[model samples]
Target: MTAATFQWLTLVTLTALTFSVAETGLSGSSILIPVLLATLLKGRLVIDRFMALQGVSGPWRWVVLGWLLLVLGLIAYTFLYS
Candidate 1:
């Protein structure tokens, strides 16, 4: 299998897992944390693959990834604190 194929599969699997968790209709920190983590992974995949930032050896990749992490971290913190 090719790298692209593997990444596609990983994205699909992560999306399904997140969707299943949502369908459970249980919104607690414990459950939401996993969902958020899955979202973070999905975001990374998109930023790397769809955004064409993977293996580029530049600051742009880290900048984008850092932004993603910050956004997700705030979301998770809010969920946990509230």
Candidate 2:
């Protein structure tokens, strides 16, 4: 793997680990929402960077973007409505 890709993957992995720790420590309802969001964001960075998603064609990029948006929307609704 290229140096940049490897670096990105390492960063993403660290972010994921941090999020896991944060989730375990945070208990209140308000903190729960932010912790969950941080987890999702770390996942998004992995998919977008290490996966080389931005190098894909326009249509594929849009599809991935749509999926990301959908996921974020679901997360927002869940936290807001629950």
Candidate 3:
């Protein structure tokens, strides 16, 4: 499949995974894993697809990816550890 189609699939899967995780009534470690996966998928799609960073060159793509990673990291840390 093309990159665009793959990205769309990733988004749909993330949505389903997030919803299932919320509905399953999980707690502790089990719960944290799916949430983290979904968050990472969102970051990947945002950087590689929605923002079109994958089509860019040099420092621009890295800068965007780095910023997204930082935000996603902070969110995951807060959600799991705090």
Candidate that would win on lDDT: 1
Higher lDDT: candidate 2 or 3? Answer: 3
Return whichever of 1 and 3 wins on TM-score. Answer: 1
On a 0 to 100 scale, what is the lDDT of residue 57 in model 1? 87
lDDT of 1: 0.88
lDDT of 2 by residue, 1-82 (tens): 9867776776777677666766677655556566556656765665677676877866875687678768877877777777
Total colliding residue pairs, candidate 2: 0
Candidate 2 backbone collisions, by pair: none
Q: Alpha-carbon error at 50 in model 2, in Å?
A: 1.8
| Per-residue accuracy of model 3 over 1-82 as CA lDDT, tens digit each | 9978888888888888888888988877678776876777788788777888787767987887787778777876777786
Error of 3 at 7 (Å): 2.0
Model 2: lowest-lDDT 10 consecutive positions: 27-36
Model 3 regions more than 4 Å off: none
Q: Residue 51, candidate 2: how far off, in angstroms? A: 1.7
True-vs-predicted CA distance for residue 7, candidate 2, Å: 4.2
Clashing pairs in 3: none
